[model samples]
Target chain A: MLLEMLQSLPQVLIDGLALGAVYAVVALGYTMVYGILQLINFAHGEIFMTGAFIGTTFFILLMGMGWVSSVPQIFVLILVLIVTACLTGLLGMGIERVAYRPLRNAPRLIPLITAIGISFILQDVIRFIAELSSGNYIVTGPSLFTDQMTISFSSLSSIFNDASFKTSFLIVLVTAFILMISLDYFINRTKWGTAMRAVALDRETASLMSINVNKTISITFFIGSALGGATGVLFAVQYGTIDPFIGFILGMKAFIAAVLGGIGNIRGAMLGGILLGLLEMFASANLTLLTGGIFGAEYKDVFAFSILILVLIFKPEGLLGKPTAEKV
Target chain B: MPILEVNNIETYYGGIQALKGISVYVNKGEIVTLIGSNGAGKSTTLKSISGLAKVKTGSILFKGKETMNKPVHETCLLGMAHVPEGRKIFSTLTVKENLLMGAFSVNNKQLIEERMEIVFGHFPILKKRLEQKGGTMSGGEQQMLAIGRALMMEPELLMLDEPSMGLAPIIVEQIFDIIKKLNQNGITILLVEQNAYQALNIAHRGYVIRNGEIVLSGKGSELIENIEIRDAYLA
Candidate 1:
């Protein structure tokens, strides 16, 4: 039994890691924008959803245009996804420039409410498109990725014949790792990164240093939105479906991951995401099994939210975040 | 020509006036001082020049341009640097990053590198603490870093606001000496202080402010010798 459990640990860890990578990517959208603006882009998850929709639409359009036969489909999918990310990222920038920029000096709540409004607006926009195209509240799109690739480490030939959960897990792991490393480099090793850190540390001081504060803020939104966009596409591939409303819960969870890791710290978000994913997995695995099937699988969300609330009350700064004291 | 000219500027914090129509000037290569008690708006004047606070009714010309309403970055670009009171160093950044931030307006890497060398030469302490975080430094060291940061900008006029606010007398003397040396090196200065005696000793001109208005303005030596001003402000 002990040997069986030990072997299952890696499998559990791998599954948790895959889930965590997605959360980290989504959490970055929140953490990056928050670091610079000190505002939570509540609409970030929707931006992620928009990315998925954009990728899905491109895949459908490519298949419709009969372009799939001329080129490798995955290559075309990658290009389309990038273009979609750029578009969504630009949209996020526009939202910052128009809605949040005017209220830059206003009380924080006003912008937060505006963010919620933008979230709803994007949700409606996606729903409207879904409805207009299909005349239905639900959106149905062609799948860009199929779960054909699998890796199995099984002694039994029957088990080996069954497709393992490697493809979805691998895509999540690889995409997340590449995106995070590149982002870390972009933030640390570039002039724009220095300006970003300066703005995050102190906006007034950055402006005092003759750095264009407005441009820095806009670029932050742009990058954050792009990350969200990429997450959207990846999420669709992982889940095998896309929905306009998927962002609502996922955005909230990513936000929870951000808070768990240390909201302003970049690496913390990644850490938080993976931990949250594992916590959910363990809770679902043991707790649902222990209650003799009455507790059910849906309570997993409740467990995750309960953890968030408890963490907030006990350590408001999150796990790795330092508690900042106001300077007199 | 004066590198900076502040003329009849009124600044207020929600109806209670902080600076009541204050006018001052620092000609090229001169050390001018604004000395006053707490709440007399000595810091306010420096803040106004640096675009930290709004000027309700006045004109501030930096290098022949009306810079009253320009934002902080715009003013910094026009060759004006401010070392604000309380040593507002970017605490999380390294000493090197702090110095580099001062040169944000200048994209020319060669000039920035030259200016950074000059800044490090003046404050060798900063060179040693280049990789250390700004907040971890001693109060005196932070003050030196603040001055070094301003110098990195290579401003025509450098404004120091209460560099002696919190420090040991020995550190204070060292800082004042550095101020004199910096002025000797041809950077115009507008020094603000409540320590009237030490400020006037190094200053070419001094303005004595009381209750947000200038009560006395004269040559630094003459102000130091005035019986009423000396007894009221200086020991």
Candidate 2:
């Protein structure tokens, strides 16, 4: 049993890394919205779901146009990714302006409730559109980057076996890494990025610096939601199947990743995401073996949440979160 | 004409009123101070003029343009800077990022650097701490950074809310000296302070506020000597 578990480790790592990349990108949306507004945008997962539908719609349309054969599949993916990102970004901004901004100064619970409401609205709207057009909300996008590749880990160690992944896995990893790195550069190096940070820190003071508080909030939503949307596209391409409900579970896991990393810290969210993915994958792959088949791999979520509870109890500031010291 | 003319401005925090028909003005090239006890509407008056607090009635004319009811960033673009209470610095950001925010309205990179140089001249310590996070600085250094930040825009009127608060007496004196020097450089100043004596000493004109009303207004020199000010504010 130990030898079998060891042999599966490499495969688990590859699959876990791909899933973690998705979680990392989505978790950034949670972290950024929470960072600026101190409000959890519950609609974020719905935005992710909407992106999947939008991406599939684009993919289907492109195939109908015969672009699937003429255009490189990679270029088609880029087009779908960009279009999905912009639409979802606009949806995010509209949600903020309509539902969140008015209740900004109201009781904190008010916005949280409104966020949940917006989430339902987005879910229903996408379901309606999908069912109306295709007779089912469950979508299976055209396969792209279906080619497979293998890594021979068994050559290095007798305990490890070869690990193989679809070419889409590399595509997912590269895209997510590019998104994360560019976001980091934008936040640290660009002028608007600095304004966003200032506004996040202190709104009234940021205005004194000529940073428009409302506009900055809008921009934050745009960027965060755009990343989520793009990640949704990546998810569809890798898994080959998507439904309107996929975002709910995946988004919940990503939120857990954010909490594990520190909700408002960007880098923390990224690290938390990838780590949670690896841990969850590892648990799912090896739980039955390790536990002598008493607990099945289905207990992976429970295992993930158990870790969250432990982190909350032991280090509430998270791995990279500031201690939030009260000033004298 | 005064560079900033705030006439009969009344502001509210929810249903509770904070400023009740409070009027104040600052002329070009002068340091005007508002000295009042805690919760006496000094900060509210500054907030009202700087567009942070909404005014229910009356108008605020800055640089001869009506800036009241406009957005806060619009007020900043109109050449008005407010270093709010407690030195509201972007604590998580570095000193350089903080200053970059101060020049947010300026599109010219050369002008931003020029403004940074001017701010550095006023608070040289900030130049050395450019990479340090704003929150990690000491109280005195934070105050200097706050003032230096306000100067980044080269505002026609600089409104400082308690620039001397939470600092040693010597640091307070140094800040007041900078206010005086800034005025001499042709920047109009509206200073609000709890330290009445120091504020009035540096101010060319001063207003005494009480219970959301301006109880007295006079030249800074006379206000410092007034029997009423001495009894109520001076220890």
| Global lDDT scores for all candidate models | 0.84, 0.89
Worst 10 residues of 2 chain A by lDDT: A319-328
Identify the runs in model 2 with alpha carbons over 4 angstroms from their true place. A326-328, B231-235
**Measured by C-alpha RMSD in angstroms, how accurate is candidate 2?**
1.3
lDDT of 2 at B143: 89
Q: What lDDT is reached at residue A73 by model 1?
A: 55
TM-score of 1: 0.92
Name the candidate that leads on DockQ: 2
DockQ of each candidate's interface versus the true one?
0.59, 0.80
Query: For model 2, how does the per-residue alpha-carbon lDDT over A123-205 read when each residue is reduced to its tens digit?
Result: 88888888999899888998889898999999999899899999999999999999999998898899999888888888889
Model 1 docking grade: medium
Off by over 4 Å in 1: A1-8, A152-163, A166-168, A290-294, A309-314, A326-328, B230-235
- Write model 2 residue lDDT over B1-235, tens digit each, in one string: 9899988988999999888898888888989999989998999998888888889999988878898989888888888899999998888889998888888888999999999999999899999999999999999998898888888888888899999888999998899889889988988899999999889898899999988989899999999889888655543
Tens-place lDDT per residue, model 1, A1-328, is 3444343445556677888898998898899999898899999999998888887777677778775758865687578768987998999999998999999999999999999999999999998998798787455556544565644544433322222464656766888888888888888766787789889988876777888899999998998899889888878777767778999999999999999999978888888898888777655655556566777667877777788888889999998888886332
